[model samples]
Target: MYISYKPLWHTLIERNMRKEDLRLAAGLTTNMIANMGKGKHISMETLTKICETLNCDISDVIELERE
Candidate 1:
């Protein structure tokens, strides 16, 4: 299985937010954002921060996929 952050990107676009904006708003580091861009897995704590910052749920950020 693989994890995808497609929904998160869509959400950001819908909110008119840039990656930098999300980093600042969610207190995430540049590395974290970069890793996500590369389809890397992040910690649940980080995910929670993103969800809270965006007023969204975990489902709005990531999804599991069969490879």
Candidate 2:
């Protein structure tokens, strides 16, 4: 299974938040954000930070895909 982050784009749109704003609010570095954009696996702690920052659930950010 692969994880997708397409929902994050939607969430950003719904929240009217920019990627840079999310990075700042989540205390994430550009490289980390870039990695996430590339669908790289991130730590649970980082995921939690993102969820908290965006006031969203994990399902609002990541998705599971069958390969």
> Highest TM-score among the candidates is held by which one?
1
**In model 2, where do residues sit more than 4 Å from their true spots?**
none
- Clash totals for all candidate models: 0, 0
lDDT of 2 by residue, 1-67 (tens): 9998889989998989999999999999998889988999888898899999988899999999998
Candidate 1, residue 25: the lDDT equals 91
Model 1 alpha-carbon drift over 4 Å, by segment: none
Residue pairs with backbone atoms closer than 3 Å in model 2 (clashes) = none
Using Cα atoms with residue i matched to residue i, what is each candidate's TM-score against the true structure? 0.97, 0.93
Q: What TM-score quantifies how close candidate 2 is to the native fold?
A: 0.93
Which one wins on lDDT? 1
lDDT of 1 by residue, 1-67 (tens): 9999999999999999999999999999999999999999999999999999999999989999899
- For candidate 2, give the lDDT of residue 55: 88
Instruction: Provide the overall lDDT of each model, using Cα atoms, as 2-decimal numbers.
Output: 0.96, 0.92
Clashes (candidate 1):
0
